[model samples]
Target chain A: MTQNPQITPEWIAVDCSATQMRATAMGAAGPLAQATGETSKDLEAALLCLIAPWLSAQTTPVIACGWDAAPFRAVPCMPADAATLVDIPTEDARISLRIAPGLSQTNPADMMCGEETVIAGALALNPDFDGVICLPGLHSRWVHVSAKEVVSFQTFLTGELFSLLSQPDDTLDGFDPTAFEAALSETLSRPEKLGAKLFSLRAEVALMGLSPRAARSGLVGLLIGTELAAAKPYWLGQPIILIGAPGQCDHYAHALRQQGITPATLDAGDCALAGLSKLRGLL
Target chain B: MTQNPQITPEWIAVDCSATQMRATAMGAAGPLAQATGETSKDLEAALLCLIAPWLSAQTTPVIACGWDAAPFRAVPCMPADAATLVDIPTEDARISLRIAPGLSQTNPADMMCGEETVIAGALALNPDFDGVICLPGLHSRWVHVSAKEVVSFQTFLTGELFSLLSQPDDTLDGFDPTAFEAALSETLSRPEKLGAKLFSLRAEVALMGLSPRAARSGLVGLLIGTELAAAKPYWLGQPIILIGAPGQCDHYAHALRQQGITPATLDAGDCALAGLSKLRGLL
Candidate 1:
């Protein structure tokens, strides 16, 4: 019997947000080891704790992306052709850390902190893929990429609203697809009715004893339906790709399919690591 | 100058919600004395405390309108024409308490616990006033009262959403009317973009250092603009009445005036009392 030897990573990539931070060890092929932790008051200490095992005596390049970057501290106006990186001077000389700059738009006055990396990675994967990319998360971003340059983008607070509305440990039991589709369709056609429709969840529960799964699906459908209507111009006749966790992407894919559009899915973590990889080349 | 003599009332009108309870002493003309208190575990005790000075030896009728009633416990299905009142069956023999029933709709599965009293009061003010009545509160209600009957109504979680988004004790300092009108117009035209427009409030604050007053007005404008878009059917070409606290009603009126509608304003507490006064006549 024989055992294959282990391979070491060339660098490390970390994506930190207000709520969570994820670190991935990058190898030549892809991600090797990954760690995640809840964002704490001391994020740097938390990041070091998660990636300590991967840190070595040698000065290894570690690229970080998310809210910690300079671009994210304020409203950043990065041009479509802008590819800038900000180095985070670390206390330990052995660890070389740099953060990727996020993208911002002026007209709508919108900004994105973390999802820019995923868009970068998606763009890297398909250099010629010029279309709209949907990244679902706490603050979902719908980005428009053309000619290998990131153009304007919009951010939707769909995931944040859902989290605020649902219980911490809430989980869907037996999701009803019919309910979800119906809500999605109705909301898409009449997005303005959202302010009134949201409370119906409580009404249904109080009156008909709506199941947890049905309620969960209904909430998600309403949020996504409203998002789709706003982002209609972006996905009207463009190739669309969704990047997020499997569950999040599944919901988005289902909603888009209901609108007669088929979108390809990409792993969020991999895209983040891949985006950091692309930024590594620029650095 | 001679002082007007104090007048005693025959009955008391109370409006109780999940958060607070308001009581009004009804004289022959209108409300004479008003009292309010935060809702506690013992609601009946709280109600007694609020109206203790007004309690008389006689079985003074206390007409209550709020979540304390049976229909509010769960999803109530009271028809538009169903103006039923339930007795509170108080332990106090000197108190005769009865609660006004709320209105519920079936198609959209909507229900209101406290605002029905305001609608009833508005109808009582003008029996032939066949138009829409906008009740602004935590769950703002847009009610249709045709021929003194509640044909249908809708509820928007505008106030609730604003509370969740704002900090506690947050006050708008020097509210910018121009900014609010601009946002209201923009959102009314593009209501679906609300999900995206909301996050920009945070971005503008971070990037541009937006004033709290402007930000507050923007949030209010976005919410009310969306509500107006949904309730357009109710207020368009109709004689509208705004029923709520002065501050809330002012905002509704300002928004309506932007659309060239001058809605008559009515004090919510007085209207609740007046509604109870009308119900007392029937009893």
Candidate 2:
């Protein structure tokens, strides 16, 4: 049998956000040929400049584009609205571009935000993952991906809520995060009087004059406990995979393990890169 | 025999929320003419109807405008700032008024909410009250009233927080509230292992197929515990006066008593009304 000829494909990955845009170029072998990132409020200019460098490298047939966020892209339509690709301009600035369908939920019409793409990308790296995936930060997302698709997800207002609760205003402020982390660790160990401990924030202030930091720590503990309560039903008996900040992941992992749930975390960027690489051909 | 002339003062009580206005014609001997009440959203209109009959009957200066919400009476220098009034129009259309402010802080900028009216009202009934007054609800307010003025207060998003944590959208729909209340009562009986019980929402769903209602109840317990933690600082071994829902007050009373804080609950409306009545002259 004659061996099939090798074909090099030009590809681009556009990761868009409210504040910035990141774009990457990849070869057929999934290696980054060139990368561009820009911080701008306007995504249109960012996207145009992001893919401009890759166009001159090689004029390959059927250029593939891996796009995320609300940035525009085009592809051919398939049956039942699946893979329904639209048209893209074939100008020098606007070459071939493709968009992958991020996780979409109807009924309420809620969709994941920027960080979720990275999370979805992470899950794409491990197709066999069958558990809870926690993306921790100010606005943490817990996405459930199974059987080649994102099944359901929930967002915990952990970071922002903590900020608001800890710092009611300028006069009031938060204490060291270590105190919060320590309280979290201790609360997880017992996991019994967690609520009582949470309620103690105001009590501590009233009784012991808990500084803004301590009050903030108390709030952090309470929010974490509340989030755990919310996530329990969805993640019961399932292993947890965390992405995002290392310290936050460690805290959550410690908390989860104390509660007898297995937890594992990986770097967010690596997952996105791996996911973008694998989907290069399709893009 | 010589006797000081008895002075009866005319009084008006305005409940903006309920859209009810009341006026009592008085003399030094106490209420001389009939007191009247009318239902109206317009404060001026309601007041006219309530006091018009009394005004026609006799000529007496309106000693004071006792109103619950700040909008009922407009005094230029009394409050100094309208923004400082704690109780205002609620979201509900049916309730046409807000809670009024009691005493002002020396800081000028420092002022408490209308719930201060309740504490004042409670004190009007029990002037020697020296403890924590917990106004539990969606926006739980904890006030430490000392020497007839509110010394300190804090707000807790306990009820709203609980709803967000347990119910979380329409996912846990069609939940029976009765069963949840029972479970909540059971949880309240033993405050030692509340954290475990709080987390048990997920456990129950997994192990026993807990219904949405049961999960909601678990959330309430968690909120109570969290609220307790926040209020603990201000407790200062003072008695807890629950000024909201009777059932909730009883639950909190039981919880606080277990934690070694004495608790007493009064009629929520009575406190609100009395608070409004006491502030009638100021408004």
Candidate 3:
């Protein structure tokens, strides 16, 4: 939709993940229009694809998060508006773009890009919320939150490992829940066996005719379960909210359930939008 | 070396790995001629690339191993003359082709292809010897041998994991030995931390300015160390021998040395030839 003289978007919220970038034209009420595209294109071109139609004579401030835009803010700091926004110059005349930096931790070096904005959104939505927030992705992040501050965090390449070892792409369907749970328990209990466990999956197929569904599910369970074992310090005995895509969150939630703990879930895109809006309001 | 009338090859030994195929023409003394090519080529043509010149009017047997050639021979059986030679049909009139079967194990469900032949050769070279044989590869295999029999074996996809997580292919050079040792020790003690440990390598690179050599070496160490932790049952209280490419065997040997265990090393292709020649002698 071209700029409707009648309705002007106050600002646009953009989230640039490692693979893709998305933008939403936000009015005072909510999102007026949205556009999504790959990050592989020229960054300016990608941004214009969304905001060109919405551009007005008045500079449209674009609050963006992701793509490792700026230096990370070390943790043990408030999650809400944690980063100092770095103003990014634009080629377009009417676009005023700014990027929110990601977060980092020193002790066991870890970092997060878009997730920090999502975490900021979560903290802004529920200021009193304190505990753990897990964002599952190619490299799943487990974060500790207390009194609106991100205490510490850890990252796991489990998602990446699963994809490479198994299908290289996974989904919600075609996974055996039973196999998933069994694998979850296996790795959680005997994590050292993980080295051999992955190969055993192939052998099982060659020897036992393990179904594709079972193998995929088992891979998901194994990697997540191993992550849980490592992140026990962050997750166990702490309330958790998994903020990510629904399908992965379902698996994380189920895996946590097996350990007698249930985690709340939130859509990452919504949280990112909320975060951008919240950060914009502060500006 | 085109069908040399002076040095007639009695038979040819071919070893086809997942990615490449190699053949060595054997005379009464030793290898008469050798050639290597990609397995992606037609299997018969790849074999003929080396054997074509050596081919004479008289039938010259080609004893081949690898490429999961025939059905696997289950273990708790002698690695020596373990598999029945599966007669393979060949298009070339002078090519009398046969493939030695690989080995498989029940319970944990594991399998090995070309490495089985290497094990046979190791045993043939030293009859009445018994212990554990570690054949490291994309899928490293650890075999338990007693009285010339492969009692049991386990496979770890650590090499595959390292490739997927860090570099898809690795070699001996450009790795920090100190970093490697530290990572190996850490994983050997706390294997559960592997999920986080992988990311820490990236974090270390990002935050700590870890060198490429250090990161690559650390990854190699961490994966191998964790494998050692899992295969403790196989290596503990048992004499060990590592058979693989020199670069990989060096890393494995060093990792084992850290645990107060020293493993003998051998060239995998050499062992494969020995096993094929020994098996050929039986025929």
Best by TM-score: 3
Return the lDDT, model 2, position B271: 63
Candidate 3 local Cα displacement, residue A167, angstroms = 2.8
Write down the DockQ of candidate 3: 0.85
Instruction: Estimate, for each residue in B127-166, the C-alpha lDDT of model 3 and write its tens digit.
Output: 7778999999988989999988899999999888877777
For model 1, chain A alone compared with the true chain A gives a TM-score of 0.89
For residues A1-283, could you state the per-residue lDDT of candidate 1 as single tens digits?
Answer: 1122353468888987778899887887778877888888876788777777776678878888874548652233322122467777888776788777666667678887777787777777877787889989888888887777667788888898888777679754566887788778877999998888888776777667777788788888888899999999988888999998888889899999887899999998777777778887765
lDDT of 3 at B64: 85
Clashing residue pairs, backbone N/CA/C < 3 A, model 3: A163-A168
Residue ranges of candidate 3 with Cα displaced over 4 Å:
A1-7, A168-172, B1-6, B168-172
- Residue lDDT tens for model 1, B183-204: 7987799999888988887778
Steric overlap count per candidate = 0, 30, 1
Q: Output the better candidate (1/2) by TM-score.
A: 1
TM-score of chain A of 3: 0.94
Q: Write the per-residue lDDT of candidate 2 for residues B1-283, one digit (tens) a residue.
A: 1222342345434433333344444544444443345556565566555555444333334422234344222111322122444443433332223344443332111233344555667887788777678877655767776665566666665665564455446465444445545544554443333433443455456435666666665566556765565466766577777887776776577667657777778986666555545554345
Candidate 2's C-alpha runs over 4 A off are A1-9, A28-41, A49-92, A106-110, A113-120, A166-207, A211-213, B1-117, B123-139, B142-155, B158-283
